[model samples]
Target chain A: MGTVEFAGVSKTFGGKTVVQALAEVDLRIGEGEFVALLGPSGCGKSTLLNILAGFEQLTSGSVRFDSRAISNPGPDRGVVFQEASLLPWLTVWDNVVFGPKVQGVARSIYEPKAEAILKIVGLEGFKKALPVQLSGGMRQRVGIARVLVMEPRALLMDEPFGALDAQTRLSMQQLLLDVWQKLKTTVLFVTHDIDEAILLADRVCVMSARPGRISREIPITLPRPRSIDDLTNPAFIQFKAAIMTEMRGAHGAH
Target chain B: MPLAGQLSSSLLAFILPVSLIAFWQLSGTNGVIFGGALPTPDRVWTAWVNWAFGTPTFGLNPYVGTWLQNVIFSAERVAKGFLVAIATGVPLGIAIGWSRLFAKLVDPTIQWLRPVPITAWLPISIAIFGIRDFGAIFLITLGAFYPIVINATQGARAVDKNWIRAAQMMGASQAATLWRVVLPAAMPSIFTGLRIGLGIGWTAVIVAEMVAVKSGLGYVLWDAYYVGRMDIVLADMVSIGLLGYLSDRLIVALSGWLLTWHRLQSFNQ
Candidate 1:
């Protein structure tokens, strides 16, 4: 069974000016599937991600996790924000284990898991370092590590590496690809970068702005277990071209 | 290397005060201003030394051998009153900031009462509690409470929306989020309130002591003034300034220690 299902979900911000942030959107992701919601700036891509993560309520329709309606944020769905919003006062280790600790999970169960995840994110030596002490990329790594420690059923990444420099962004993308390949958790990645959508996702769901809706769902035909080296490949270029054309068409329609 | 730099900065800070003291002594000797009521540096020093060390000879010099007792009494009252203000003010401020109902109910009353100066409260304080320690304490607490509560409310209310959302996303309950996320986020502002509140508390204690109570440095100040012992009054004023400065320094040191992470971030940057 699919782990996440969004059926005809629509979100309106307020009563006076009913902004249809999402419109009759329907998506179903099987367990361990990595999908990207690719779109322009105000295309409701993030709105969709927020809904799945239980940060926002739908105005119409419903969202379910394993056939149960998702009402609030929980450890089952871990979200990584664009700014890498790790608590500034907390040490890296504290931020990483915050989820399990708050959920009342015993130290014996989560400590080792947190340690391993920190190692995976290449932040093992920075366990005691404060979030403000680290570089932007390093902070985002801690953000990823924190979510990973929860062993969540799914990941909702809202342009997690969008704030970094181009070099750091590429490295972070590769790091995420490596992590997701091993974990195989269902991911609903939101971003505006066409190349990034083509690089990381199994299928890129391109969205349009203002009363947003999915414009195209283009499947990337790239093989699994991919790496950053695939960026120059012909298949990757083809996928990027397809997404860019779809987005251009969207812009024209608007 | 940084420690040496800090040490030199510390030494440099003393230069201005030392130079001002030397100038004051030089001007006093040269009779640059009123030389009678304004005692010279040496005369003030002699009076302070007598106040500290001289024996009480048949109540002729009440200022003599009474400094420590009065200092203790005043310090104790300020400490007690300021602590009371913090204990009550912090929680009340958090509640007022967190809930609309509480803010609506309590904020107007606080605003109405805040404008009446601490001096105005002296008569009421004396009436209610008589010429007791509680009267002085009451005045001190009332004086300090306003700034502490208001600043704390500002701090609590200004917590970032994202941080709250992040905490909720992690499965933290409402109470846990308030305690863990909100309180910590508001700490810098709360400390600001505390420092301001403490300064007011000291002022209030002195004012209350000057009129309502018969002990403490403020009472001594008033008594010495009436007896034409302006030298003792001047010494008392200096002592109060020194105490206030030291207390503020203590708070700043505490804040620096507690907020090491915040300090390090700014300093390193």
Candidate 2:
């Protein structure tokens, strides 16, 4: 069974006027597939991600994970928001372990795992620091670590690095790539950045705005174990140029 | 370094009050204002010393050596009332903020009653409790309750949507989400409520003492004033001010200790 399925999904905001944030959307992501939903703002890309994360309900149709209808947010599907959204009162360690702690998992099982995730995210010595004490990029790293500690079946990322500086963004992207390469977990990454879409996903599903729907799906045939240096490759630019043209075409059609 | 700075600031703070006392002493001797109805600084000082240390001579001078007892009475009432307010207010506020139905059911009554000042509640409190500590405590609780509940509601409602989502995604049930996520997130604002509530509680205690009950700093203040012992009255007022200041400092210090993470975040930023 596909890890996630969205069939004829639709969402409306209020009773009087229907927003049609997503309409007649159909998608099936297999287990361990890293799918990037690329679109302009207001394209409902994030809304689709929210639906999959069980943060929002669809007005019609259905969404399923592992053949089970997704009803509410659960440990099986971890979501990373655009903003880091780390609890300001919680230190890095507390935020990371919040998931396991709330789940009532034994401390013995999650403590070392959380410590490992923190180290992987390069926050080994800063566990005691609060979110506000960290830079924007570091905060996002903590956000990722917190989810990873849950060992979630799928990762739903909604512009998770959108607010960072260019340097920080590149490093974060690289970090994500490294983490994903190792885990090979199913990921649904939403972003407006074409280069990011090209760099991260096994397949980029380009979307169109308002009454949002996936307009095109392009596969990335790049070699495995991708690095920051891959951005300089000829294939990378070619992919970017093609996606850019497609995005422009989509924008023109809108 | 910080200790030195604190010492210097406190010393600087005393300068104005000391100069004011000297001026008041000079003016009172010459009957410069109110024909000496306002006591001289030395007289006020002597009265406070006697209130602190004098033996009760047949309890004729009620003001003598009664300062500690009255201070304790008022402080204990405030402490009890404030605790009761917090115990009830916080949970109710969180419920109202978290649930629209609860808000609709309970919020309007709160708003309607909030405008009736604690001072206005004195007659009802006295009638209900018959001039006991309960009467004073009732007024203090009523006075402190509003701010604590309102601020806690604001705090609970202001929790970030993403944080809620994140917690739910982590397998937190509704109750866990509230206790773990909502309460901790709301704590900074709750602390704000507590500080404000404590101040109001002190105010309510004094008001209650002056009218509903007969044994607190406020009662002593009015009694001394009526007896034309302006020095004792001034000393009582000073005592109230000092107590209020000390209690607020205590709350601030508690908040500082508990919210060290929040403080460090802002400081580093």
Candidate 3:
């Protein structure tokens, strides 16, 4: 039910001088596939995700989700922002159930589901705490839990752990890996971290800035049920080296 | 009694006012100052006490014991006006901030009208609503509207884009997004407007009462001035100042409660 296809998509930002952000991008992901767009800042990686999430519109071409053209964001495709972006006024539980509650889902259906997701994210006891009182890691847990409670078919994350400390990032990555492995939701994760792309995604699409375009598509041939510990595996190291090399090549071209 | 440390912090605040009061008292003799052009604080205090608690007389003096009644009249006018301002200004401001088309259609007119002082509108208000309580309330509402609307617009406009996107992705309709997200997010700024608007409300009510209405503190101040009763005028001025301060304090307290999460976020940062 979760498939994303981008066909000849282009985006541009208008200022005194026009700058092309994305140039004729084409990509496709099958149901339940985890694809990471690996690139540096300003590479239009976030822009592409936003376009697919319907937060931004493409200058030309179309985006499809579940074989249907999508023009606006909906509960079916959940986005996890980099800064967590939990409403400062809301408590953990309120933030977690915001999606379902706003969509007018019955309390009977979402309350139990939200509770379970909070438990999965290890935030059961902290549900009453405001987002401001939470650590960055804990806030991101609420971010993930909120989307999960909506039972989205596709998860779109843009560097969800980029703002966290190194230790917190690793823990979050592990948490994400566990959740994704269990749910098998089609995922589009955007990150500049090469190790993150290799450790978490089934496929990595390397991209470059200045008229942002995909540079390479590498399939990760690693075993399932992966954890952050796999960063030490020889196969994982090989994938990281390849992604780093591709990134350097993209930078050199720029 | 307050704790010693608490008293110490507020001690600094009382210095300037207390010193000024002492100087004024000393500058006066027999509770008359500047040859009775201005009554001393003691005279004003006596007048306030009498006006506040004196029995009503069936004589020529209408303000013999009408202080509390006038106060209630003025306060009720300000309250009604400010409520009307909130009812119209907040939603309009949110619309102006949220949608460019709405702003284009309504904002310029508001900005153009905002510069016309409430005193200038006294005649037009009187013409429309007549010399009754509604005229005073209308002027107050008009006076308070500008600050409330401008502040609310600024608040709604300043909401983080990501928050809107988050709400959109969560399947919130346009109405839900405005009510559930934009309204709450804009609350801090709206409260700012409310405080400023309320200050203007007090000003408008006084102006309206002085010219259009025959009651309230403003009427008494002008009446006392004409009738050689400077004591009541000074007392009325103090009453207005007190009311303004108390009303602002009420808004601040409410904002402190409503925006607790926002306060904590800022504190953490």
**Candidate whose TM-score is highest:** 3
**A92-177 per-residue lDDT for model 3 (tens digits):** 98888888888788999999999899999999999899988889999999999989998898999999999999999999999999
Model 3 misplaced regions, further than 4 Å: B1-3, B30-33
Instruction: Give me the iRMSD of candidate 1, please.
Output: 1.5
Cα misplacement distance, residue A139 of candidate 3 (Å)? 1.0
Shift of residue A114 alpha carbon in model 2, Å: 1.0
How much RMSD separates candidate 3 from the native structure? 1.6
Question: How high is the lDDT of residue B39 in model 2?
Answer: 84
Where does model 1 sit among the CAPRI classes?
A: medium
lDDT of each: 0.89, 0.91, 0.92
TM-score of chain A of each: 0.97, 0.97, 0.99
Better of 2 and 3 by lDDT: 3
Candidate 2 lDDT over B181-250, as tens digits, reads 8988888889999989999998999888888888999889888888899999899988999999999899
RMSD of each: 2.2, 1.9, 1.6
| Model 3, C-alpha of A85: deviation from truth (Å) | 1.4
lDDT of 1 at A153: 87
CA shift at B109, candidate 2, in angstroms?
Answer: 0.4
User: Mind giving the per-residue lDDT tens digits that candidate 1 earns over A86-179?
Assistant: 8777899999888888889999999999988888889999999999899999999998998888888889999998999999999999999999
